[model samples]
Structures are given as C-alpha cells and as structure tokens.
Target: MTKITYVTTHGERIDTEAENGATVMETAIMNAVPGIVAECGGACTCATCHVYIDDAWRETVGGPSSMEEDMLDFAFDVKDSSRLSCQIKVRDALDGLVVHVPSRQG
Candidate 1:
C-alpha cells in the first residue's frame, strides 16, 4: 500500500493508504477523502477527478494521455500541474505521492 495525501483547495488535508495498483481517485473515493467525484469511474472522460500533483512528486508521475488532457480542460481551476487522478496508477514509485484537489468538481 501507499500513503497518499490529498489537500483540498481550501487547504483541508486527508492522508490515507491505497493499494499500490489503484488509481489515485479510486483511493480517494473509497476512503471518502473528499474533493474527487470520479463521475466517469476512471475512464479519463470526466474532469471531476481533477487534482494537482505535488511538485516534488511530479517527475515520478506518468504523463496524461490526449484524452485526459482534453477532459482536463473542463475541470475547475485547471493549471499546468493539474492531472486527472484516475489517469495516475499508483505504484511503488508513488508511495509518497501527494495531490491537491480543487474546491469544486462534478
């Protein structure tokens, strides 16, 4: 398992453990960590799972696909650091991953 810390836009922080292979949003929703709605269930078709991966761990995360990028355009407060959590597969490399959720999402 990995310890993923989620910080909401209002600065609320939630720390939880997640199975190594689970997508970041899956963990959040399962734990009810708040901020991630995951409206499309990790299909990369919804921006409701939008998150900003911590800068320190950015290099460790996989890049977004064209579909994820296109959908991200619809998220609240979209930024360069934004990512669709459903697109990030957790693993050993992401054990200490931290992401910030925007204040709003579907």
Candidate 2:
C-alpha cells in the first residue's frame, strides 16, 4: 500500500493508505475523506475530484494529460498544480504523495 496525505480546505490533514493499482480518487472515496466529492466516480467526466499536487511531489506525480487538462478547465481555482485525483494511480513510487483539496468544487 502507498501512504497518501490529503489536506482539506479547512486545514484538516488526513493520512491514508491506498492499495496499489487503485486511483487516488478511489482511495479518497473509500476512506470517506472529506473534500473529495468524486461526483463522477472514477470517470474523468467531472472535476469534483480536483486537487493540487504538492510541489515537492510534482515531478513524481507528473502533470495532467490532454484530456484531464480539458476537464480541469471546469475545476474551481485551477492552478499549475491542479489535477484530477481520478487520474492519479496509486503505486510504490507515490508512497508519500501529498494533495490539497480546494476550498470548493466547481
């Protein structure tokens, strides 16, 4: 399992373990982590699962794909670090991934 940290807009920091092969959005939904609405489930159709990848892990996490970039246009407060959690798969390399939830969903 990989360890992932999610910082809510309210400043609540939640650390959870995610099974390898699962998407970050899946982990958040499974753990009932607040701030990750995941309205479209794991489909890349909605922007409710928006998150900001921590700067330290940006290189490791990588940027959004062209499709994801298009979807992010509907996300609130999009930033250079913005990403859809559904697009991020859990793996050993991302053991210490950190993501920040925006104050509100788009």
Candidate 3:
C-alpha cells in the first residue's frame, strides 16, 4: 500500500493508504477526503475532482492530457498546477504523495 496525504485549503489533512491500481480520486472519496466530488467517477469527464498536485511531486505526476485539459478549463479556480485527481492513478512510484484540495469545486 502507498500512503497519500491530502491537504485541504482550510488545512485539514487526510492521509490514506491506497492500492497501486486505484486512482487518487478513488482513495480520496472512499476515505471521505473533501473537495473532490468525482462526479464522473474517474472517467476524466468532470472537473469536480480538481486538485493541486504538490509542486514537489509535479515532475512525477505531470499535467493532464488534452481531454482532461479540456475538462479542467471548466473547473473552478483552475491553476497552473491543477489536475483532476481521478486521472492520477496510484503506483509504487507515487508512494508518500501529497496533494492539496482547493477551496472550491465546481
């Protein structure tokens, strides 16, 4: 299992141990991590799963693809580092990852 720490804009911290095959959004929603609605359930269609991937981990987890990029444009408060958490799959390489939840999700 890999531990992924989720930090909210309000400073709430949620740490979850996730399986390698699960996506970040799956672990987050299942563990009740706030700010990610995941309305499309990892289909990469909804931006409700928007999150800011911590800068230190950006190289390992880069930006979204064209499709996910298009969808992100619709999310609220999209930033240079914004990403749809549902699209970030958990892997052994991503263990001990940390991401931040935005103040809003639309």
Candidate 4:
C-alpha cells in the first residue's frame, strides 16, 4: 500500500494507505479525510476535490492535464501547486505523498 497524508485547511493531518491504482481522491474518500468532496466521483468533471500538491512532491506529481487545467479554472485559490485529487493516481512511487486540502472547494 502507498501511504498518503492529507493536511486539512484547519491544519489537521489525516494519514491513510491505499492500494496501487486508486486515485488520491479515492483514498481520501475511503479514509473519510475531510475537504475532498469528489462530487463527480473521480470523473475529473469538477473541482470539488481540489488540493495543493506539497512543494516537495510537486515534481513527482507533475502538472495537471490540459483538460484538468480547464476545470481547475473553477477551483478556489488556484496556485502553481493546485490539483484535483481525482486526477492523481496512487502508486508505490508516491508512498509518502502529501497534499493540502484547501479551505473550501470550488
């Protein structure tokens, strides 16, 4: 399993483990991590699962796809690190992946 850490807007940390091939959003939902609404259920259709990729993991996580970028335009407080959790797939390489949940979803 890949370990994932979610830092909530209120500064709470939620740790979880997920099997390979699950999306970050799925991990969040499964573990009841707050702030990742996943309104479209990992379809990448909305920005409800918006999160900030930790600066240290930015290179590893990479940039969002053009389609995801289009949707991110609707996200709140978007930054160079902003990403929709649903677009991030879990894998061994991201074992200690950390992401920050925004104060609110778009």
User: Which one is best on lDDT?
Assistant: 4
- Candidate 4 per-residue lDDT, tens place, 25-86, comes to 99999999988899999998999999999999999999999999999999999999999999
For every model shown, what is its TM-score relative to the native structure? 0.93, 0.97, 0.96, 0.98
User: Which numbered prediction scores highest in TM-score against the true structure?
Assistant: 4
Candidate 1 lDDT trough over 10 residues, lowest sum: 58-67
Clash number by candidate, in order: 0, 0, 0, 0
Candidate with more favorable, higher TM-score: 2 or 3: 2
Residue 64 of model 3 has an lDDT of 86
Cα lDDT tens digits, model 1, 25-82, are 9999998977789988988888999999889988789668888889987888887888
Tens digits of per-residue lDDT for model 2, 1-106? 8999999988888999999999999999998888889999879999999999999999999999999999999999999999999999999999999999999987
Candidate 2, 26: how far from true, in Å? 0.5
**What are the per-model C-alpha RMSD values against the true structure?**
1.2, 0.6, 0.8, 0.5
Candidate 2: lDDT of 49?
Answer: 96
